[model samples]
Target: MNATGEGEAAPRQIEVLASVRGRVMCMDSAYDVDEANRGRDVCVNSSYCGVLPARFIAEHRPRAAIGMDCGVGPEGSAIAGLWYLEALGIPAAVADVMTAHLGDGVHLYHHGIVSFANQPALDCGVTAGMAVREAAALLLEHDPVAAAASEITNRTVMETTPDGRSVVAADSIAFGTSEDTDRNVLVTAGHTGRSAVPYLRRCRPFGFICSDGGRGLNDSGMAGLYLVEADGLAGATVDARRARMGSGLSHYHDGIISAVNALAAAAGVEIGMACPQAAHHLLHRRPPTASPVP
Candidate 1:
């Protein structure tokens, strides 16, 4: 038995065979000799792969032989075992993908265990249970609280331009020091399909200038960039962040923070480098307040 209170034995394999048998029975060609021969071959193979080994242990009582014969070795045997288990209605457990950096190149790993649910595919870059665990751990390394805050405060808006062009607008929050306090607001909107650089240039016409996220531009929408502002900006930023995180707007490969940062940079804004926990608290820790600025 596994953790979920389900048996480790194969059960779904029987269900598959039952389904196939039902289909065969309904077919007019079921009486064909060739089909009959094929069916016999399938049954024999299924029995050899599925029923025989299980029955050997359950009925014959040859304990040592069962263990020895069932030992994992060649891929062919592993495949046979998998097919057998499938035939027997047994479910197998598979691994998840893992990503790792070694020197310069990235490495993919896989788990060895078999599973029916959550089965990792080839090219999934996972090979072992340990690899799946490690990948999960790596993902969790980012502070959930901070990620939540980031997601809430950043907003990505899509609009159509006057010239029949689709445009994307991104607004975010930024900090202002006493010396340069022009209510440091980052407002970046651009032609939707083009790269960030051209979009930044377009926004420049509307007093949206600055590239605080970084030096170069990333055309990939996967990047997180947001336009920043001051005044009611902090509150708006916090509120947005809270709303997004609460609504489950952020997701895998979405790069919410990266997009926010990119937009902030394009708008020449400065953002506070707060810890993820602190950011989360800032976004969700406060109560609602009425705003006079529209």
Candidate 2:
């Protein structure tokens, strides 16, 4: 059992769930927001209303956007991003974490319940307790706002092993690269959901860590860690409550390890360990044998 008295259940396998509806799109991560979806309505799985993520979404200029509420963390930081979108004149809403998987946008669209809506979204007829599909439809009724200027942010190289392996902090695993294969440790801010599996499989980083996203909805939030374990890649997740979500620097410096896959555990990662210490162990461990990509 975990510190919370919850058993470590099996992680469910899922795909990159997405759908396009005329001018509307549903995707699993905010990183997926791009020129292709610009001027469209979108729903993504990134924490609903996170400041950084909101800014990212705003850059794409979607007519409206929906995201996961992230359990509305400390001082309402989780939903605070909605205010940014509201100011941009874009309607935005967040799904209740309890009603949908935190990192799967298609699941959110089909099963999510709206927990909060910014003023602009409210004006668009989105309301608390509304179904995500219904809310997204309402968002479609609005027109796109001018895109926000994109920000320039770079990944941080947090630590380097004596052998030259580096620990890199990226806001999302989508930032991972082919060069990461067998060469680095990546600490990311996104959840360890099944949608993340492909990135880990493709990059095959020596080790990695991501947020547990409050372990929402049957602990589906950290589901990708187990899949990575099957590939012999060391992996673990930070407790979402211990650090700000969507900030990899926070995951590396302020996070507490909440779960560890068998491969990570074998490398000396334990639940409750400091994230930096776990990264140390992972950086020093030998890379696992390459596994076939799914």
Candidate 3:
């Protein structure tokens, strides 16, 4: 029993109930919207089959999902929700289904089964489910085992602007054993040429480490490299890159090695080469473009 004299259930139970509630609510709301929209369309078509309706169905209809914001305008909000779940000791696999609400206010709604093993109840403060009193009770009843779960999955929300593109970054630490440490490498695929360049420039002799094959740099003109001292990455590299780009969209070809370097420099840490062949193969395939010798 919990402080409130109620029996505490497992986390899995809480998730199951929440999932059921979310699903039912979502379905009912969607059905109502469809019915209203359908009725309106039928009326319009009956009135004038040859001409378009005065009001289009999309213009007057509400979305099927009440709290979801899947449009471009809400991309940042969606990403934020994903990060939030990750910070709570949940892995990305479980966090992906959570939806973000961006109407008049912002909120996250979990629509999956609540299980002690996977979707544990949130600690007391979260107001996503209901008022604190009800939310706490529900959580305790559903996911009592959460208290014993590992906290290593904790994460932090970060806002990053890569090449003038604003992105809500979710940063997490992934540790490795001695056996895996020697093979650890930082791998990033290039959508723009600048992706791997900044790190190479900042690391110098150590440079960014890469796998021997570097097969991951599939994009044309893309490059990849490994960080020799993964521990020494500070924020200097990223800052420099951001400064160079200014306000407008960054050129696809400009590598942002400098920005990554800034992050490494700021952290006062260095990362080791985990995969040299992968880096070499990628860089070799799309060698950095040359500028006229000054």
| lDDT per model vs. reference | 0.24, 0.79, 0.24
Q: Write out the backbone clash pairs for model 2.
A: 48-68, 49-81
| Tens digits of per-residue lDDT for model 1, 21-120 | 2211111111111223222111111111223343332232110010111233364342243334333332222221112211101111122121212111
User: For residues 1-294, could you state the per-residue lDDT of candidate 2 as single tens digits?
Assistant: 222345652122222233454355666677677776666545444456789889988888877788988889998898888888888787888989999876666678788899988756766778889998888777776543344322212378999877778999987887888878988999998899999999889988989999998998989999999977767789999999998777788899999999999999989999999999999999987666567999
> Model 1, which residues run further than 4 Å from truth?
1-12, 15-224, 228-294
Clash number for each model: 46, 2, 68
lDDT of 3 at 135: 35
TM-score for predicted model 3 compared with the true structure: 0.24
The RMSD of every model to the true structure, in order and in angstroms, is 19.2, 17.6, 18.6
- Which whole-number lDDT from 0 to 100 does residue 118 have in model 2? 73
* Error at 87, model 1, angstroms: 27
Output the number of the TM-score-best candidate. Answer: 2
Of candidates 3 and 2, the better by lDDT:
2
TM-score of each: 0.19, 0.51, 0.24
